[model samples]
Target: MDLDDHGLTFSADAVMDETEELRNPFPSPPSHYTKYTTHNLDLLALYNERLPDRRNESQAQILADQTDVPDWPLTQLEKPRIDWILEEPEPYYDVFGERWFVKDKIPSLGEGGGTQLYPEDPTVDRRPALLGILRSLLVTYSQLTSAILAPPPSINLSPANTEPPKPEWEEKVEWITVLAQNLMAAANDLRPVQARGNLELMMQRQLQLRREETKALHDKCDILDAKLNELRAAAQLISSRGDSTDVAMSDPTPTKVVPDDVLAEDVLRWAEEVE
Candidate 1:
């Protein structure tokens, strides 16, 4: 049968025999007659002219190009075809008017009846990474608390010694501070649009406040250390003078301990706010 009689035409010089019926995944609808042709329809040239890489291409032009020349390497040959047959052929296009051409009949995992143990994007579910970071941070904070409860290291409070007393909580504080900072960064990176309600900003602000609090604690500890040093020096001077009178040294100022309860409360508040 003449392919033209059926309103369909293709190159007789194609690798496939023209006598055999051509395979058309997108068969024209019976109700809507389609006159497929390739005359003067340089699909590549038309695509280059109309659908530029970074230009406003019309939807009609893109769909026409995709339907005519689906493959790029094989689109060089101008095979037999026609022009417009139906007012609107069934085709899908993106918001940018780019046509979505079908290359294969492979069904997606959703419809193929198969289990996708892993998603295409590993970070699609960031809960695992976020949870791991949070757990590490919690453990670090717990260590800081324990270190605070632990006895301060022995120090020689001598004016001549010139050894500045380091606070026991300082190391632990730094660890927790670094961990908290990392957690905040990770949280921000993994923030989903659906769950976002200034949550990333809140986390950033909270981390900043935590750093400020830590700095204040460090300052307080320094002041206490200075006072303790002065008292020790006074006692030493009195003893050197061979004074029989007892030189009573004043008690060192207490350092503020960061409570884990406060941290827990803040986390709970964030959760509630998000909810």
Candidate 2:
């Protein structure tokens, strides 16, 4: 693996297993194809050009050792000789196309009932492998015909079923019942305490409200007291003004000197008026 700024990279092997994946990278169909658009046609052409060439089975299985799993190495030479004659000649392609090809029947070879043997490797006896395959098939068939198993599958736990056994279940139920009863008793016991807490909270809330009301009243009193002080000052100013005014009436013009002579004459008249 080579590390680069982008990411770690590795050389891709000629892994023919992903042959189908090459087609996936091709351009997809356009949304509207009612009419031929130049872009769409161009894309189709490009897609055709990019398509990988079809490979023969032998060539596809590059690692011959690994390809033996699917491809027959023996198929390289020629199709095996079959004795039975068919009305139609079997079709075949040299490059291993969609269909396998069979050559014209060689009337020279007689009917054979067994699998083809490796003539070169004469020491290879296929009887043992055939018997082993037959045994496996028999075992598989027997298992398929056997009775159905209805056993419940276990989840995360392995020791037992998710549901406990009867005795353990009963014990659990009893314990739950006792727990519920205890819970009920405890709730019953806490009722008075809970109520007391609630009442205390209410009392505290009421006290807070009363304090607010008192503060509001005090604010109003302060306002009124200020108003009263203003009024008192105004009243004091009026009283002082009235007290500073003249206490007795005074003549505007000066008293005349003839007033004495006139007063002597007026005194008799005044005495007469008084009498």
Quantify all predictions' global Cα lDDT against the true fold.
Answer: 0.56, 0.48
- Model 2, 66: alpha-carbon shift in Å? 99
Question: Per-residue alpha-carbon lDDT of model 2 for 186-250, expressed as tens digits?
Answer: 34445677999999999999999999999999999999999999999999999887776643234
Q: How well does each candidate superpose onto the true structure, as a TM-score?
A: 0.23, 0.28
Please write out the lDDT profile of model 1 over residues 1-275, one tens digit for every residue. Answer: 23653244556554243222233444334321222335324554665565556356443446553554442232334333333222236433332223453332333333455332223353487566557757876887787788888886777778787877667578767766665655554444445553675787888999999999999999999999999999999999978865543333343666558565578778789999999
Query: lDDT for model 2, on a 0 to 1 scale?
Result: 0.48
lDDT of 2 at 78: 31
TM-score of 1: 0.23
After superposition, candidate 1 runs with Cα above 4 Å error: 1-128, 157-162, 195-275
